[model samples]
Target chain A: MIKLQNIEKVYRTDTIETLALNGINLHVAKGEFLSIMGPSGCGKSTLLNIMGLLDEPSKGELHIDGHTVTRLSDKELAGFRNKRLGFIFQSYHLINDLNVLDNVELPLLYRKVNAKERRRLAAAALEKVGLSNRLQHFPSQLSGGQKQRVAIARAIVGEPEIILADEPTGNLDSAMGNEVMDILIQLNQHDKTTIVMVTHDEQMARKTHRLVRLFDGSQVQ
Target chain B: MLKNYFKIAIAVLKRRKFFTFISLFGISFTLATLLVLTAFLDRIVNHEYPDAKRKQSLYISGIEERGERARSNSGLSISYIKRYVLPMKLPGAIAFSSRSNGTNTYFHGKKIGIDYKFVNSVFWDILEFDFLEGKPFTVQQEKNLEKVAVISQDLRDNYFGKDVPAVGQYLEANNEKYRVTGVVRNVPASTYMLSSDMYIPYTLTKDDMNTPSYFGEYAAILLAKKTSDIPAIKKEYEDIVRRVPHTQKRFLKTTSLADSYLDAYIRGGSQESKQKVWVYTALGIFISLIVFLPIVNLVNINVTRIMERSSEIGVRKAFGATRKALVYQFIVENIILTLIGGLVGLVLAQLVMIILNNADLIKNLHLSLNFTVLFIGLLTCLVFGFLSGVYPAWRMSRFPIVKALKA
Candidate 1:
């Protein structure tokens, strides 16, 4: 579950100011799968980033899983992210130097999990995404779809309550995009995991439980 | 966690080949030059041969005689040593020796140069010399003005071929022939007063102290029964100087101080503590410059290297890596880089010392990487790693996650 009430985000320069998110109000209940649809420069990813605690809203209040995260210190925010939330970026932000297993083990590393346990959990997550055979493969060695699956595995590896994915299949072909979408839908349906996804594709948006569209930094529907 | 950091560090280093090469080259070259210099300084300050008893020995190097119209400061005279130092009950033994003087000789149409010193028989008893052949001349031999000499291994090899025995052979210097009584290992030239090509009987020299003068080209050593006895012996000598009447003084007062070997070198014929401080401070500054300049250059290089890893840092932050964890990881990576460079430096230092020893640029100058020098060199490398790694790691740790992700 996630909550943002009247959240505002602004980008500033010496000569100009621009609003990335304006007076946004949104919520996703427990076990709900929500997709945000927006055009280019519509602040969809910005909203997802704020919900993920990766960026601070210039003026807003955010509550996630019964805790107000806006007042948490940076250290606490990191700990919260490690324990309560997981993120899957559009670019498949798995560390290139780490193997597929190590990439999935990243959040668990911050939780002080033993290496053996981390490896076991990471392997299980990879199995869920049907990528158990690619545990030793690097990000560069994986195909676009395989990389996105690996990112999804990483997002679910920690068993966080909520997952925030920013255009998880944006760089994949339609076939690979469908493969990734199927994995997300199965996770939401089978594991009762809550997921917030940002996308521009209407077909993918239609598969979610609900869809919110944004225009010029404001929610239109 | 540390193991993971190590794995990532090594991977990142392998990923960027050019940056790693440049960093390693700078670190290894700087450390190699420093290790060599450290070896040279170690040899000068603490030699293991010839002057092995230096820690338990004290030397009265120079004498000063002041009068109304003139003041003369020179090396201790034989008369002054006979009257004041030899009578001291605290010292186990007292010996006198003169400064080295250069002399040349010809053997088999080849000209060979020698630096010789005039030493009393008791000199051999106080200093530990490793003899390869024969024995030192006795006190009776010195008293009888016998024509005998103790030559270094190098001099023996030069005067007589290595195949031939040197003990019973004759060596000619200053148009005088003396039978070779002993052949000892060559003392390194850095051990100022103890290094010479050959040693001859002091009685054979013509510096007769018939006149009661307190100055000549001679020095005296008072070897303590134990290292703990040195202060008492020095105090006794100072007491003698204070009590002795200034008879036949060119001016008014006579004074001299017995000092330890290193202290004497630092004093440079002066009793001023300021001179010692100045020398030590200069040495400190010299070592700092050697270590500091390289660290500054390395810090700049490390900053650039870490900046290129900004995206990795951001990804780590997003994955729950704390600032402390990231900084620690970067520093660990840097330490591994420097430690690898340190190993390479040690090898380089040994090779350079071999080349220098073979070059024979300075007479009897043999430099080796003793344990102390090697330990200090390693410590310097660790310090270099910490100092160079800190600023870049701090900057990277403070990097804004959003901006770094964009990068």
Candidate 2:
């Protein structure tokens, strides 16, 4: 579960100020598959980033999985993120130098997991994403759809409580996009995993359990 | 985790071949130069043969006479050593030697230049030399002004055939023939005072050595019975010097200094404690610059190189890597890089040493990577790795995740 009360984010420069998020209040229950829709510059990714604890909100309170994450120190926040949440980026931000298995093993590394166990779990997660055959393939060697699938396996490798996906299918064709959406649905329905996705695709939003729209840094629906 | 870091580091290096080559070249060249320098300095300051008891010996290298119109600073005369230094109650041996003179000798129609020194028989008792044949001339031989000499291995090889026996053979120099009594190991040229090609008794020289004058081309070596007694010997020498009795009327007062070979090389005029401070400080600064300049350049290069990995850092941080972890990973990567460079440098330094020793750049100087030099080279590599790696690692670790991701 997640909760937010009057979260605000501001970007500042010497001569200009921009409000990225303004008094945003939103929440999602356990096991919910939620999609956020917004136009360009509407703070959808900013909100997802705040929720993932990748960025701090300027002024507000945020509670994730019954913990007040806004007050955690940087080190504590890193630990929290490693143990509780995972992220999938639009660009499939897998380290190009690491093979698919090693990329999936990244989050588990911070947990001090033994290398053997990490490899086993990483392989299993890759299998779940239908990428067992690509374990040794590098990110550069993978196709776009395969790369996105590898990113999904990496995101779920740690078995995090929440998954934040920022435009996971933004760069894929319709068939690949639907395949990714189908995997997310299976994870939500079968594994009871909670996911928050940010997208501009109405069709993708229609597949989710709930939709929230953002306009000019505010939650509009 | 470290394995992963190594994997990425190797991948990145292989991906950026030009940068890796440039970095490796700089590190290897700097380290090789440093290793060569270390070998040369080690030979000069801690050489064996002739000065093996260097720690337990002191040298009265020069005497200073101050007159109203004229001042002179020169080596001690033989008579001055007899009256002022030999009577010292300190438990030690006193030996004096004339400055080496260069002479040309002919053998088989080829000209060979030899440096010769006139030393007292006690010189053998004061310093240790590795003799390959025969023995040092006795005190009686020296007192009798016998025409005998000890020759270096190199000189023997040059004067006689390489495989020929040199002992009991006559070596002619300056039109004077002396039977070689001993063939000792060659002394490195850096040990200038004891590096002569041949040593002969001072009594055999034509010039009067026992002049009452305070200056001559002669220096004395005082070897303490124990290393700890060196201070006592120095104090006794100072007491005798204060009572020097104004030998020359025009040069009314005389002053002199006896010091360790290192101190003698650094501070020549007087043995003041203040001068010792200046000597060590200057040496410290010189060494620091030699070490620090290369590190600064490496740090500059590393900063730019690490910046290119900002996105990788961002991904790690986002996944769960603490700043400490990232910094540690980067430093390890750097250490690995420099250690490879260090191996290359070690080989390069050995090659350079072989070329230098064979070329006869400075006669009799053999630069080899002894244990001490090798240990120092390793330490320099580690220091270079840590110092150059730290700042760039810290800077990269501090990059905000959002900014690094954008980069």
After superposition on all CA atoms, what RMSD does each candidate show versus the true structure? 3.1, 2.1
Error of 1 at A154 (Å): 1.4
- Complex DockQ, candidate 2: 0.73
Error of 1 at A32 (Å): 1.8
Model 2 stretches with alpha carbons more than 4 Å out: B66-71, B208-212, B245-254, B265-282
The structural similarity of chain B in model 2 to the true chain B, as TM-score, is 0.93
What tens-digit string does per-residue lDDT give for candidate 2 at A72-136?
Answer: 88799889888888888888888988999999999999997999999999999999999999989
The candidates' interface RMSDs, in order, read 1.1, 0.9
| CAPRI tier for the interface of model 2 | medium
- Compared with the true structure, model 1 gives a TM-score of 0.91
Candidate 2 lDDT for residue B406: 77
Candidate 1 residue spans exceeding 4 A from truth: A12-18, B63-74, B77-84, B87-89, B208-216, B237-257, B268-272
